[model samples]
Every structure is written in C-alpha cells, then in structure tokens.
Target: MQTEPNSNPNGQDVLLPPDGDDVPRVQDLDLNLLKAFHAVYVEKNVGRAALRLGMTQPSVSHALSRLRLVFRDALFVRTPGGVEATPRAQRLAGSIDRVLRILQDMLDEGAQFCAATSRRVFRLHMSDFAESAFLPTLMRELDTRAPGVVIETHHIEDSQFNMAIESGRIDFALGHFPHASSHFHFSELLQERYVLLMARRVARRLELDEHFTLGLNAPDGLHFIAVTSHPQATELLERYGLTSRVRLAVPNFMVVPAILSRCDYALIVPHTVARAFSTPGDSAMFEIDDASTWPVNAYWHRRFDADPGHRWLRGLLMELFRIGAREPFDSWLGAPLDLAPDSAHNA
Candidate 1:
C-alpha cells in the first residue's frame, strides 16, 4: 500500500493509501471501475458492457481488470455465449444498482420537475385519521397534475418510524410526531385541537350545547372511547379525571365514529377528525375549551431535503393545507363545517 501525505488540519490521525493501492479504501475506489463492474454484471459480456457504457472493449477490459485487482477475484468468468458473474459479482450487483440509483436521483434534482412525465413513487406514513382527512384531496391533486406518479401509504407506529425513514422505506410521515433528531427534517402542515365527538341524539339527550364544556370533572355516566395510539388525548382525559371513565379502547380513530354512533360514548379526537365523522344527523362535534393544540407535520430524512421530487411533494402539501391558502380545506371536504381561523397555525 502507498501512503498519501497527511493533510489533517486538526491534528487528528488519518491513514490512507494513494489511488494505486492494491486494496483500495472506499475513498480510493474508482467510480469508473464500479460502473464497469455494474455494466458487466448486467450485460454479462465485456463487449456488450463496453457498448452500454459508451466505451471501447479494451477500455472496459482494463476497467474490469482494475476491479478484479481491487476485489481480489475474477468477478466475471468467460463463457461460450457471453460471460457469467461469479458469486462475489452477484453479491455486489444489488448494492451497485442502489448506488447508481442514488446518483441518478441526485443528478435529477438539478432539473426542473415535470410531473406530467416523471414516474416517481412517493411513500408516506400516516395515521388513519390523516388518511381519511387528507387522502381524498391529495389523490385528486395527484390525478390532475401527476398522473404517472404513484403514492403508497403505510400506517406505522412512531416508535419504528425513524428507522423506516432512514432506510428510505418511507418518504414522508404526516401526523403529530414528537421532536425529531438532527438526522431528520420536519415541517408543520397543520395544527389540530382536540374535540369531543358524540352521537347527535346523545348530545341532545345530555343537553350539551354546541360549545359543550367537560368542566373540571368527567361527566357523570359518560363512557369514554379512547384511541390507544393517542397519548395526548388519553392524557387530556386523565387530566380531566376521565381515565377511569374509559370503557372501550380502540387501536385507531377509524372506528371511533362508528363506535360512537351505536353507543353513547364520548371520544376525544382532533377537530379535523371530529368534522370528518360529524354528519348532519349522526354525530356532533364540540370544541374543547382548554384543549392543547397538537401539530401535524410532514417528516422526512435530512438526506432528502434537497431532492426535487420530495421537495415538490412537500410543496404541494403545504400549498393545499398551510395556514393560508387560496381555497379552504372545508370546501375540499364537501361539507359546510366552519373551521376556526387559527386552526392551522404555521410552525
């Protein structure tokens, strides 16, 4: 191994070899050699790989020779028809493809986004409530603007979401997430305050006004329906001394409306969800006076902060739901519900 000159400014020890080292470090590995390896692995023939790479056969051969020397293996063996990749070459193919794709995406970021032509797939992590409230409008916009784009949604727990975003399994997470780490980026999309949801008949029977107050004590004989995932909602219930009042605990907000319809239980949910569940004669929504407003944000890894496709998606969401936009989201929901002026405070 040939050692290069130490160029450390902070007096930290750094050991590296020159580019001609027998066993190259990651920094010393030639990108051309890796590209050659990928081409060879895909084409299975040196002549064809050279053609695909827009290089001469001898140049590709030389590049393959360097790759073999660096990897210490004959990555490809000659065959009668063409060539076959060795076990080592086969193992390197997947990683090399992923690297090429990342590079391509980075290159594409510099170009303007053409939604009409681009076929990008965006993966989102959202709760059931967010899906119910936002997906309809989001899909409509996608259909009109980016007909070729695909959207995949996953309902993942917050505990495992960081890993999912880091691994690129999820492109964006839209919901009330806690503070993110330095490796992640977040922007507030909407702010939602919790509200009480109950059947219209139940509300009428209890003599609850439009602005019903829970008072300092849990309402007598009130069976609370709790969403298992919302700790803040549960905490509010506990603060109002309503924990013991919980009779049924459900996994998500999807079934809360249905559960409240047949039963007389009161559910604490976001005002957006309350409005979504409330119908003219089925359910009624009321604002909680002392409720703390939680923010619904779009979270992504810091790595994608500058990605054009990701930025476009985030921009579209912000345009539609940010504090002030041309159209009211209530119109998108096709309901005459009145939204609080300060409901979606920007953050």
Candidate 2:
C-alpha cells in the first residue's frame, strides 16, 4: 500500500494510514490534492469542481493528471457529455468521503463536540407551511441538545427549489414532495392531512356535524382563499371540489392564520401547519379534510446522502416527531373521519 504525501502542516501524524493498513505508498502525492479529486468525482466535471474549489480549470486538470500518473490508473473516464467514475474512482470515492469528514473534524477540534456542548450552524430549506409547523419545535429541541447551535432557514419556493437543491445552494429541503425526480435522496419525515380553516365566528354560524353539513351549504360569499406556497394546494382544493373561486392567493402560509382570524376567508393547509399557526386565544380549525394527506419529506441531493451532519439533522427531525420514515395518518391525526360518500348520498 502506498502512503500519500503529508500536506498537513501538523505533519504526517494528522492522517496516518489506518492500523498498518495495506494501502499504497504515495509518499510523493500531495494529500491536499485529494480534495480536488473528491470534488471532481462528486461533481463529475473538472471545470465546475474547480470553480467549487476556487481554483482555475488548468490547475485542476494538472492536479488530476498528476494523480493519474502517481496511481498509474485512469481514475475517471470522460464521456461525450461529462466524466464518469472508473472502477478505481468508485472505490476511491467512499474512502475520500471518510477522509474529508475527518479533515472537517480536525479543522474544528477546538470546537470539540460533546454533543451536549457543541454549538454549530445548520442550514435548511423549507416551504412557508413547513416553517410554521416544524421550525419552532425543532429549534426548541436543538436548544436543549446543542444550545449554541443556530439553525438558519431559507424559503424554497415551488419555482426555485429544484435548481437550488441541485446546485448545492441549500443543504436540504423540507415540504410535501412535489412530483420530483429520483436524483434526490428524499425520506418521508411525517404524514400530515390538509385541514380547512375558518374564523370561529363563521364556524359557529354553520351548525355543522362530523359530516360538515352546514359547511357545504354555506353561502358562496365566504370566498375561499388558497395559499400557493406549495403547488399541491390548488390541486388539493380541486380534488375536494372547490376550484371555481380563489378570493385570495398568497405566497406565504404563515400569514394565513392572521387572514383567517380577521375574515370569513377559509384556507386549506396541513393539519400540523394549522395547529402551529393557530394562536391559542385567537384561532381554531373549522374543518379537516381527512381524506387528503401527503407525506412531508426531507429532500437532499444524493451527493449528500452519506454526509454525517446532514444525516444527523434529518434523523433528529424524525426523532422529534416520534415517527419513522413511513408513519401513517393515524399516528399523527387525532381522529379518523371517513370522507367516502356512500349510499346515503346516492339516496
């Protein structure tokens, strides 16, 4: 096994080959060059990877050439479109990932983690609805576990999300999954249902039952309002037979509770979101569309699938909800209502 050259100013002791490990001896190889290697392998583009490393394209090309000569193997092969990892490159990718993680830990040793004592900044992207629902509680848990850690959140609109995640502009995205591609590693964090929200005054005017009889009979003047922060809102409303009217359309879901609190405007949003936005003394859920539900998912590029920090945050979010990847509606919803129309409707 070849030993790569020591690039750390702290000397070779910084990253020693494992346990007299039988890895190749690359005493002449600059270990710092591996950073470039990892970036190229992950990005699959020399020019883009160089840009990521803040280096010129020619320098990245030269470093890659030197690596190929030292290893005596063609690590990557260029296709007509882009570069593809060769067999050796594939094997090296995992090792490189581990090495980079260790490098990060080394750089932050002064900020030694006791978990109980570590304070760090984590970034996440979420739609407005998710921000209202999970950010508060998630922050509370973080405050207890890692009090110094600050969570920075960015809004991911339906239009800008796909590009944002792919380009690594955001760490991870949280929301009901749109009709997305398989390139992302997405996990279902929680199951949530869409609920109809109305002012208490309006709900009281309609003497409704579990079937929402008076709600169906309410005058059209109530004027349905829909939050378009998510693409699903409109489709969900149409699915439940309310497509003709949209008296108000807002991009932010957090503003919804205020709007509903002041007017007879009825809005549709997830149950968890509705609960979070409801002011204790000011608002209430007028109706819940028990039938319409979707899994709230955490999405990240496959490039980050094995990243320790990213994985930890995703797991923490799941743990806070006391649910696993595919929790059912019953696990979260308080009461089950069968929205299926039966022979009573036929009569």
Candidate 3:
C-alpha cells in the first residue's frame, strides 16, 4: 500500500516513505542546527546570529533551512526590523536555553578555580541577624583569599524564595528556612539559641531568683517588645506565654536593641543578636532555659552543587562556622569551631 506525502502549513511537500513514517530520525540530525536556531531566536537577525556563532551569513541561512525542513514549519518570519519567532519556535526557546546552560556547566566543571584571578560576584539572601554574625568573618576571609570576588546580599520575601533560587537570582540563602524541594541542596551551618536582652537598670532591680521564675501572670510591670511578624520570634513568644504582655510590635530584629535601650521593654532575640547588642554597661544578656535550638542552613540550587566557585565559598563557610565541639553560644564569639575530619558534611 502507498500513502500520500504530507504538506506543511506553507504548502511545501514533505517527502514520506511508502509506509507513511514521516517523522525524522534523531540519529540523522546535526546538533549544530539547533545551536544556529538558538542564536537566531535570541538575536532576532540573521546577520547578528551569524556574528554570534562565528559563521558566515550563508552558512547560518543554510542551517536554518535544514531546521525548518526537519520541523516542517517556518520557525521565524522576516520583518523590516528583524525576525519574529512563530508560536512553535517560541515554545521551544526555554527548553533549548536550559539544555545549553547544562552543557556549559558540565564543561566548566573540568576547569580549575583560581580565587586570585576570578572576578565572580556571588549573590546571597540573609536576614539582618545572620548578616551581623556571618558577614564580618566572611568578609575577612574573602579579603585574604578571594580578593577579587564580590558579595552582594539581598532580602528575600517568603513568597519569592523558591522562584528566586530556581531562576539563579540569588545564589545562597542563609537562615532557618524549611526543607526545600529536591532541586535544591542544603547543609546545616550551625544551631542557634534565643536569649533575653534587658536594660542594665532592669537587670539590677530584679532579684535573680524571682527573674528566673517569672510567670506570664506576674505583674512586675515588664512589657515585652515582640517581633510579631517573624514566625520564629512569634512562636518563641507564644511558647513562653509572653504574647499577652506585648506592648509594642516590630517587624525585624535589628531595631530591638535601640528600642530596649530607651525603654524598660525586654526582647527575646537570637544569641548572635544578643551578643552584638550586649555591650558593657548598656544591655545585659541572659540565656533562656529550655529554649529550642533552630538550625541555620545554607541553601543552593542543585545545578551549582558541583560548580568550582560555589564549592569554594561553601567550603569556607562550613570550615568557619559549622558547630562541632564548641558550645553553641560560645561559637559565635571569636573562638573557632572545631573541624574534625569526619564532620565535613556539617557545612
């Protein structure tokens, strides 16, 4: 039996076998044709695409012709300004770009990473408390090791966190975020505990025995300053039954020190923030008994797991901050955390 040949949208006859198996064989296709199509789709002009691909105009045009034949469509239509992609071409652009990116990353894995010569910029998302605790040590290390590398930090909203990491807008997010999708890779950096900060006069006025046992119903004229918008802070307040005594609601941890210094209000803050704010004769810090310890982690997309530049940075962070043998509260001080041979995965 014989079958009629197929006709494309432009009325061009596409030759078919006797059995009507019209699909092109994958083994017979040249990968370079796809590269040419990608260049033209991005540049929107044949001449510019040729320039980008380091090929002559006729060569690029020939590749495009073969691509059109295989797809059975006019992928792009020429106009006075440039070329406009057809619906079919538009649909394929994203997948093509992703494939090319993966190929490039694979090639880069073989190259050696030289910190002195690399001018890479790393983007990170971190809360103000993490900034206060981590940035100083990180900066010192970068200045000595990777002098040319630049670090840019941004504040990420909860709604945009997953999208931002997937799209490569942010490289690493540092804090106590929940477990991410399998597409993301995360390692615990350290564990953090909460503490209470109060003014010097208040600390001196309250008896030590009574202060430790103070209940939510104790009318000792203590008004709590709460970070109601943050999940961790809100949960901590409610767990200790201090939500009813809240006299002021703030949005972040950075402003708590300034507010507490001027008023009699007390704040429950991360141990790092407590250390930063508790200067001599100003504010006093006290450990909250039986408070839960939260894990601080560093997150990156799985695409960058093997990248040389990213691996170097992640290693440095792990070496500097990973909690091993030191006490949780004392690790944030100038003392270095113990780095045992078997504890490499903590970072």
Candidate 4:
C-alpha cells in the first residue's frame, strides 16, 4: 500500500530525518493538502480534524506526515486530550487560514450558487438589537427559500469585527460600529432615534398626572433600566440628568421587555428596538427629545468582496433590512444549477 513513511506506521509515529534542499516547496502542496494541515492545526486532534475534512484517520495522519516533512517540524505533539501545536504551527495558523479564505473567495467568485438546494451554514455576528429586530424576519424568509441552509449567530464585541470577518469566524455583523475602517465595508440599516419604553400602566399614571406635557421629557423620580450593549442608553441617561437614577445595568436587551413589564424602570432604546419590544396596546413609548440616534449597520471584511456566497448573503440582508427594499434579495445574476432533485430531497 502507498504510505507516508513518517506517518503513523503500525499505529505508531515514526520521526523523520532532518530537512534538506529536497524539502517540498509551498507550490508542491495542493489545496487539499494545505486544508489537511489547517484542519489538524485548528482542531488539535487528528481524528476530529479528519472528520472535519471528511477523510479517514489514516489518510489525515499521512497528510500530517507529509506536512511535517514539508515544513521540517514536528508541527504537533500528542496530548492526552488531543494535540498541541508547536511554535511553528502556531505561527503558521494565521497565514494558512487567510490563504484558505482567499482561495475560497477566488473559487466562489465565478461559481454558480443554487440557494434552493445549497446547504451552506452562514455565520453572523449579531448584536441583541439585530437579534430582536432582524433575525425573525430574515430566518422566516430563508426558511421559505433555502430550507436546507442554516445560520449560526455569534455575540461578538465591536472591536473584534475586523479579525472576526477576516478569519471567517463571522460572515456578517449588524450593530452600531464605527464606520471608518480600511478593511471593512459598513452599510447602515437604520439610523433610528432614541425612545423610552415602559409598561402601559405607568404611561396611564403619567398621563393622568398634571406634571408632564405633550412630547414629554423624562420626568423626575423614575428609575431606568440601562442596557450595556447600547452605550447610547448610558449617554442618553447622562444627557437627561438620569445617570444616578439608573436602577439596574444589564449586558443585553434580552430581558429588558420583561423588566419593563414587571417594574416601572424606563428603558432607553433605539426606535427600531423599541418597536420590536413595544406593545401597541400594553406598552407606553415616548419619543424623547434628542437628535441623538443609534445606528444599526452591517459589516463585512473587504477580502470577502468577491465570494458568491458572501455576496449573496450580504445582498439578502441588505434587501431584507434596508428601509425601502421591496423585492426578495437575489444576487445570483447567472443561471442556477438544476437542483430540483436536491430541493425535493431536502424539503
């Protein structure tokens, strides 16, 4: 049988000789071979990496053996849990992943995509705002169009946008982020004004009280629930002289609706988010006086600009959320594969 002499032989590793001028060059490695190297490096286990690459354990071991000889390093050493990368492998990880993304982009640039049958899993970094205002509609639309497709959402910090998109950790992000960036493309979805929300009972009490006026400002003596995810909430509180009146501070808006219902704490949120949480009959919403607005945006790295899948998803999102879009998003300019069988099976 053909074999890598230094690969696991008789189920045991065999160390290789020293590197020489005969070492394999980068061009000597094919895309699949480099993929094997990357999978093992990231997964830190041969069997698991093999599963990720859809190959047998022995095949992955053979590929690893070739990679070790090519790079002239042990690359990884066995650990009780899995494997630990050597310094060289650690250093190679970034460039290898970047190369893979670039090559995938190049391939997808000209590839025809059949969303009706494609079972691609897209990753997105969504803020709580997007989760509330965008996810439900986007998912419902996807369900009708691509039943086999899936979405995995990540909660990431604004600072991680560039690396997250470039590393393929996230395909798209929707949040309030600084627009000035050389590496990212930002599209504004909504630049909504700030509004306050409270339980319906509380609005009734405020309306009957003789203290407030039309287009009411925040009245004195009410506590506030501050969502840390929207820093503008805090800024608005400070602007309204209610900083010390903040009763509770939470990381996200997930529980704000419940809190508003159970307590008299006022919630300062973007008009879009407030719309999602506000009950027309049961919740009171007041437009607070301020030019201060929260901007929701979609961000992606420039490196993925040409990827067909990436472009398709981005265009779908833009059409789904942008204020004036009337049609279902479709970026596929060319004819799609005849995927009737696949669609029938997946459905």
Candidate 5:
C-alpha cells in the first residue's frame, strides 16, 4: 500500500491503497473526483488544477491515483513544465465536459438571469442584410443591459443550421427560416420586404424611375447586381426576365450600395437595409409587393426553451423587433404599415 494521506468521503484522513492495486468501482466515482480530473486535463498542471478546484495539490493527486487505477492507464504524464494527457484521457475529456455543462444547467434551473454581470458568449447566424437591419439595436441593448456578454455573428445560411446548432456552433439564428425542423423553436421577429436600389441620378438620367413606378418593363439597357446569399434574389429577377441583365454577382450585401453609388447597376435588398442606404438624395427605393412579405424569425433548438439565458435572450429579441420596438423600426424602414409596403418583397 502506498499509504498516502488522503481525505476519504467522510472528510477524514485515510491512507489510500497503492495505485493500480485497488481500482475504483463505478459506485466510487464522485463529482468532485471527476471535477479534479477535468481541471487537471484543462490546466495541464496538478498544482494549477488544485488551485482552480480550490483543493490542495495532494487531493488532486489522490483523485488522479484512483482514476488511473480504474482506467488502468496513466491518463496524464509529467511533461517539461506540466502534465500531458494520454490519448485515452483526451477522448474522455469531451464527454466529461459535456456532462458537467448539462449538470450545471440542471442545477441552474429556474434561476433568474443576471444580465448586468453575465459573461456568456452567444453565437448567432445572421445574413449581412439581417445584421444591418438588426444588430445596431441589439448591440445597444447589450451595451446598456449586459456589457460583459459577448456576441458572435456568423453568416451561415439556413440549410446548414440544423447541424450547426446540434454541434453547439450557434446559440440561435435570426432570419427567414420558415421550414426549419420541428426540433427547433421559432418566434416571429418582424416582416420585411425587399426593394430595388439604384442611384437617384442614374434612375432619373436613364428614365428608370418612371418606368419602374408605372409597372412597365424596364429598358433592355438596364443591368443588375445579385447577392448570392439569397438565391431567391436572383430567382425573383429571373421571374421578371432580368437574369440576362445581371452584370455582377456577390455574396455580401454591404458593398451593394457602394457599387450602386459608383455604377448604374441596380440591386435588390430588404426594405430595412434599403432604408439605411437609400436617402432621397442618394438612392431611390421602389416598392416591390405588399402581399408577398416574408417573416424574419428568431430560431433556436427546442431543448433550450427552459434555459434562463436562452429565454432572456429570446425575449429581448422578440421585444425589440415585435412589441416594444416595432413602431420606430417600421418608421425607420420607410413608411406606415396600413398605407402600402414600399419596399421590394422577394428577398
């Protein structure tokens, strides 16, 4: 027997059996012991791991001895300045980390969200247009409510969201995902229409503004730019027999206005986004349709429905886009709702 001084489960000092002589049974596994292993795996130093876990270095070593005997492998070995995990330990760490998180969430059930001091990092999927239309207000809300919380926005399309969310890649997505899987929860944010954007001078010089308003076929000389992220953007143009008129295509929406400023090319964009770029002096906006508007929704995995943080964030988005912030947002987008939707509706 090694006879190392270690604290037993009853909080009494006891001599532990020689490592590998007495293996820990399944019932012997304790949360603290697992926590010690995770800490050591992450910190790579027993002393640092002990400090992180608020335990003495001897306690961490004792825990490691029992774990190594049970696993029948030296899970970690002393390297130059710290310990290195064996292949088996590396494989075990991921499962243990996930279990710990799930257990923590279970313990945090019914807890109130403290947004003021939260350091939670939220990941989101948003398009360039959605970012332009939504992020400013969201950032302002974060700045005022939870300055420490971090936001990461990824421009992933809806098709890959199922895998991304399942792998814990994104916390939620904000956009038009009408046919998402049943395992996801969705709430309406707002409805938005797409619009045509072109330089005001060019519109007048080419007599394009007059022709477009009259619902007449545009001249053959007109050319367009397409944003590839919304395939519907191109399809809608194709519906109008404007596919052949597209001279340039790109994935991002941010550069469209700059391109329109310098060129005679026209691009289709969401009305909210168009509002940001289409002032009366710069760009002209044209209403596409009122009856064909698409709803931009907030989507998340249904499993997070009861998570306090998820609920808080979801509520914040719903409030910002749906209830509290709706009127001002609509006013900013261009006009009142009952009169006529004055933006493009396809994208």
Candidate 6:
C-alpha cells in the first residue's frame, strides 16, 4: 500500500524536510470558480451543482475539470457509492469551505445595495395611470443613485392578475386585490381614489348630481375616446351606479388627451391618474371625491420570497412607496419619499 508522511499537531510534516515553496496560496486560483466548487462539495454531485448554477450539466463537468487542474489533485474520487475526498482534498476541505462561505457573504452583501455601483433591474407591475405619476419620480431616483438599475413594468389586469404572479410570469404587481391568492404574498402599497376626466369647460357646466352624464353611461363603455392601460375606469364605474358606453378604448394613457380633444367624451380614472392626464389642453381631470376608495397592494409569488433578486426588488419598492405613507393630497404627487407608518395605512 502507498503511504504518505503524517503531519504533527502543529500541521508540520514529520517525515519530510520543509520545502521553500510548499505553502498554500489561493492568489493563483480563479476566485470566481469558488462558488461552483462550493456548490459541488455541498451537493456531492455534478448534476445538482449545474442546476444550482442554472447551467447545463456538461458546463458543470467542465468547471469541475478546471478545478482539478487548479488544485493539482483529483479532489473527489468516484467510489462504488459516492465521490470520496482524497488526502490532499481532505486537507483543503476546511480552508475551501471557509473561502466559499466568505465569497457567498460578499455576494450577499453586494446585493444589499450600494447605489453608486449597483446595476440591478427591478421588474414592477403597474397601470398606465400609476406609471404617469410615479414613473417620473422613479426615473429621477434611478438616474441619481441607482442609475445602473432599470425597471421593467408589468401592467396588471383583472383577468390575469392572479395567474401572472402565481406562475412567475412577472416579478410583482401593484394594484388593488379583490381577494388574496394562496400562491402569492401581498403588501399594501397605497390607496387609490376615483376621479373624472373631462374638458374643463364641461366640468364647470355639469352639476354634481348629473356628473355621470357626459354622453358616457359610466366609465368603460363611453361614447367618447378612452385611453386606459388598466381597468380603473371599469372599477370606478362599478363603485358608482353607472356604466360607460365605450366608443373607443386605447391601451395607452398618453393618448387620452389627444383622443378627448376632438370628441366630447370623458374618462373616469383615479385621482392620481387624472392628475397625470392633466395637461395644458381642451381636456383635464377632476377628482371624484364621492367614489369609494380602493386599496392598492404589491403582490409577488410565494416561491420568490426566498430569492435574493426578488428580495432586493421587494425592499426597493417598499422604500419607494413608503408603504405606510398616505397618498399626497397636494395634487401633482410629491417627490418619491417615505410615508409615515401611521398615516400610510389610510386612503
């Protein structure tokens, strides 16, 4: 049988003389591969490491091959049962384990956020109405500190709201929730109040009782051109005893002012949304103060609760919305800042 010299309690070889360059040095190795090596050691299988890395099995095999060359030994030997660590690998086990842990900690810390150097992409769900008021502020924040990060918005619809989030089709949805789903986690974002969008001249002439009679039955099926990215019109109509006789329905909110210019039609939207739709033109938005308030929320799949990327996005949103802060009543929406916890809950 082949035998090797044993080490003393002080980790010094007892049988061989000390060599000049025998000290362990990690500087020469590719530090990036440490994550892959750690995964392999923990799983004890190449296939699992590949899955964890979101790579192909062959790719993991190739990385392992490279690790062997760097370590100058077959770190793991295939036996009748499982891969076993060799003497050199055994000596490395402790140090490699610590190195892998430190690397993971660094990655986790980096993800925690340093706006100056971060380039994270945050996927958010919102309606065109919410986007009109919030996107500008969010963009300003992105350009300042989190300049490298980009936001991908998902417009939430009543038909697919539940499935889209539960199945991971999107990262998170921001809007009202009729009921909670088992597959998702919900956090309150803000309260949305209904409003009316009409020509300023028409707004002045219509009495409060006849406010619903702008040639539109309610909010959805109106005789005038309507530009809506979400179902806020339909929702607003449902709250009141009205129904819209929609003649035109466009998907973008930016087109509303143009559409409402020639036609004598109006749109019933959220107050914040109406503010966004307001411009120096023939049409403008008016708050429907009598309409019921809807609670808006941020929802995500339960499965993503533990993911690092998902958590990062969730935290960023909470910071942006200041979840407890009340919606601004000063009109044009305020700067993106934290809302006090006590006042954030009310609409």
Residue pairs in steric clash, candidate 4?
none
**Per-model tally of clashing residue pairs:** 0, 10, 0, 0, 2, 10
User: What lDDT score goes with residue 307 in model 1?
Assistant: 77
Residue 292 local lDDT, model 6: 65
lDDT of 5 by residue, 198-301 (tens): 77666666655333541236666668899998787776787777888889999878888779878988777776777655655566766653325687888898
Best-performing candidate as measured by lDDT: 1
Of candidates 6 and 1, the better by lDDT: 1
User: lDDT per residue, candidate 1, 169-272, as tens digits?
Assistant: 99998887774556888887777878777876666666665455664745576778999888878988888778888899988887876777788888888877
Candidate 6 segments exceeding 4 Å error: 1-113, 155-163, 177-180, 204-252, 260-265, 280-290, 306-308, 323-325, 329-347
Where is model 1 more than 4 Å wrong at Cα? Answer: 1-110, 157-159, 217-221, 324-331, 336-347
Give the alpha carbon lDDT tens digit for every residue of 1-347 in model 6: 23335332222333333334455357646764666666766676766777898887677666655665555555665544445566776787788789877888988874565666777676677766667767776687669867788789876667877777777777887766675476678887677776667765444344323333332234443344444555656655545545445667777777776666666666766666665555543444544545667777778888888776677667766777654555543422543222111122222
Tens-digit lDDT string for candidate 3 (75-188): 777777777788978987887788888887878755568888789999999977888778877888889999999999999888899888998899999887784556889888
Q: Judged by lDDT against the true structure, how good is candidate 6?
A: 0.61
Top candidate by TM-score: 1
TM-scores of all candidate predictions against the true structure? 0.61, 0.56, 0.60, 0.58, 0.60, 0.55
| Cα lDDT listed for each candidate | 0.75, 0.67, 0.73, 0.72, 0.74, 0.61
Q: What is the C-alpha RMSD of each candidate to the true structure, in Å?
A: 14.0, 17.3, 14.8, 18.6, 13.0, 13.6
Which has the higher lDDT value, candidate number 2 or candidate number 5? 5
The TM-score of candidate 4 is 0.58
Residue 286 in model 2: shift from native, Å? 5.0
Model 5, total clashes:
2
The superposed Cα distance between candidate 2 and the true structure at residue 319, in angstroms, equals 0.3
Clashing pairs in 3: none
Segments in model 4 whose C-alpha atoms lie over 4 Å from true places: 1-109, 208-217, 324-347
lDDT of 2 by residue, 1-347 (tens): 55443222111222223234244566856766798899889888878888899998878877876666555555766765567777877998898889889988887764434556656577788767777767777877787887877788987666878778888778778877575558988878777777766665564455333356223444555567877756666776676567576788887776776778777777776767766765443444645444456778888888866665666676787676647644333344333323222234334
* Model 5 TM-score relative to the real fold: 0.60
Residue 264 C-alpha lDDT in model 5: 88
